[model samples]
Target: MAKSKDISVVIPLYNEEESITELCKWISRVMESHGFHYEIVIVDDGSTDNSWEIINNISSENGSVKAVKFKRNYGKSAALNTAFRCSEGDVVITMDADLQDSPDEIPELFKMIKEDGYELVSGWKKKRYDPLSKTIPSKFFNYITRKITGIKLHDFNCGLKAYTSELVKSIEVYGEMHRYIPAIAKWNGFNRIGERVVQHSARKYGQTKFGLERYIYGFLDLLSITFVSKFKKRPMHFFGTMGTLSFIFGFIVATYLIGEKVYINLFLNERARGVVEQPLFFLALTALIIGVQLFLAGFLAEMISINSNKKGDYLIEKKIGL
Candidate 1:
């Protein structure tokens, strides 16, 4: 007899053939107890090892198991993106390929999304088994994300996330932004994001591919998201604001110079130097030039905001399809 599938688990795999089979067995044991139809989608992200072969064998044994292979390593984002397209379950769960993220927590994540009305539910590793090297940078990253994104979750990048199809399709998880899915989902107007403390086992296979540099990238991405959120439509609002402030500060400096000359002429009873001779004149001139450049920048940004529909286009006119 064949089992009907209701829940789809999408795992992005890269050089983890040793762990895939064990992970699948665990998933089968835990998920079948819930008495719901489920399918496992393993996205092979260009693994140089025999991961694709392993996934193919599993898919043949169990109709519920599916595999998607990439030609080369396009990263976790591309893997997830491809897996999302292949999913067919009512609930879609995303977890790491390594055996660290526990399959036992899948039921709870499923319950949260299906019953609790949460559009997205991410797992929180309150007590991670990772070393201090990984954990320290992770803490800083999560801290900044909480402050800027305001989701207040302990772990935003915990690969064990459950999502409905709506939230999945609304947000794009490219360029290391997969680590900030909660932030992206929030920016897209999905605020019903909930988090649960899930079990985090030590990695039994494969080394952590990420490094501390991801924290730096994450902080920069936070700034990018914040800017895009506040000024996506009115980019001039940001640039124009800096331009106006610079111009005003420059004007104030020039005004001070005028006042100094006025005092010398009136009180000291001496002829004052012309505005052109004062050193303040050069300062004001520099300020004015900088201000003009910023203003022009804002103007150009406004025009770009109007036409930045294609993000990959380097030359603005190239996107015009000419």
Candidate 2:
């Protein structure tokens, strides 16, 4: 077991070689000024630049700076997941390496977690430095997120956030689910989430690594988390409901068509077309087949859910006890 620290600043960086040294220095000043016993854990997400080298040098220069390098670009979620597993801080803080997320908020965030009794605290970039291109889409995304998760944080994707070590350890962040950390925490029974109006600065170095596709992925991740959180232990609840409805609808349509044909032939005493000759017959047959397939899918999903372990198993290339 590692010695517990007051705070562990976990940064997930990609090609952020230029700003890291300055970021670390700023963080060190904040931590030292606050009289905090902190460790800076930087996860280098397979940067092709000198980011890894810079990380090694920074760790050597500052003994409190620990490092982890991924073998490839596994993404921000993977980086956070790996660092959370190894953090030794009572309250863990996650921030971006782009210099947009200020280290000055660390003390207040720490206080919210320790003194204010919040399980997780998310930073809200109320006055964002980002342009309308990013901000507009972000607002739309945040609105949808707030409506769905019922956590009214203005910015769900803000990197500047704090969590109790227990909260981070209990939840898993994979894919683009990092944006929904609070939702994930809530799903794991940590509902005491707080939001702080943090200062968001303009990027000092490196262009935004993400593109418009991020919102698309974010929405997909939201749907995934919603389904998984509700039905992970019982996938049959979702798949089975859809399957049953489809099967019942198809059966009703088939029966109605068959009964109409029988009535025309027997009661009306008129010749009726054969069931197979009508297009309705094929449509009903297709629906029945689809319904059966959906039911089988639900059955298979249930079987898999019984044995599934959904936690991430990312490959760590290097670690300082991380």
Candidate 3:
């Protein structure tokens, strides 16, 4: 690792051909002005548009630009993971190809990540130009992410973010969780996180690729991150806790049912009845079953973790052909 490093800009494109040429030129100007060594990695995520031709032209003109064209669209996660695997700079920055994220904000983000010693710095669009439909759901999503991950980032879904080489290389972004990079970094012991109020422009060249269903998936991914981060190596801590709480609640419910049965049998002189046919019994049975299953899941996770440790499964083998 170098003391002062250049920035690697990674942009993931999906049918975003119109923005690629302009974005590459803009990034080149920034790189030249800042006097930092940089590479523009444009990952074409199986774009049905002429995205590859545009990226090739840009990468050819400027020696700084490199691209990986996916045979088919594998989503943003695959594109980012592939780009990160091939990036060569000390500071890795990621932005969307839709031109909503301003390239002019790159230098400041790079400065914060490199000079300020922040492991991760994410952009916050204070005044988004999105419609109420997108903005409303985004706010709720960010709130849920903060609550679950305990990372105080306002815009977890912001595409504009910069990460130190160590942090970027160490972490793996899969599923729809690239939006939660800050939280992921926090969970990986990279606690020095920062945020910058970046300039967010309305879509200039293409339509938004965002949808409401992505928020639903993002929320679910946060839950997965929460459990995996807090208890990846100790799954029993999480599952066991849930199991114990469920079992306790079930026990209380069963005890109340027993008391009710005793009173009914003695005071009312009703027929003696077994509890299994009762609804409370079914609830108790369900709880007990779920509890035991969760406990076993934790135990299984523990075994898998131990086996993984022995196997030495790693995410990044090398960076930029290192």
Tens digits of per-residue lDDT for model 2, 65-99? 99888889999999999889878899999999999
lDDT of 3: 0.82
TM-score of every prediction relative to native: 0.85, 0.95, 0.84
Name the weakest run of 10 consecutive residues (lDDT summed) in model 2: 313-322
- C-alpha lDDT of residue 124 in model 3: 95
- The candidate 3 region of ten consecutive residues with least summed lDDT is 312-321
- What's the lDDT for all of these models? 0.82, 0.91, 0.82
Q: In lDDT terms, how accurate is model 1?
A: 0.82
Model 1 is weakest, by summed lDDT over 10 consecutive residues, at: 313-322
Who is ahead in TM-score, 1 or 2?
2
Q: lDDT of model 2 at residue 123?
A: 97
Best by TM-score: 2
Off by over 4 Å in 2: 1-3
Runs of candidate 1 with Cα error greater than 4 angstroms are 1-5, 255-269, 274-279, 311-322
| Comparing 1 and 2 on lDDT, the stronger one | 2
Candidates 1 and 3 compared: the better one by TM-score is: 1
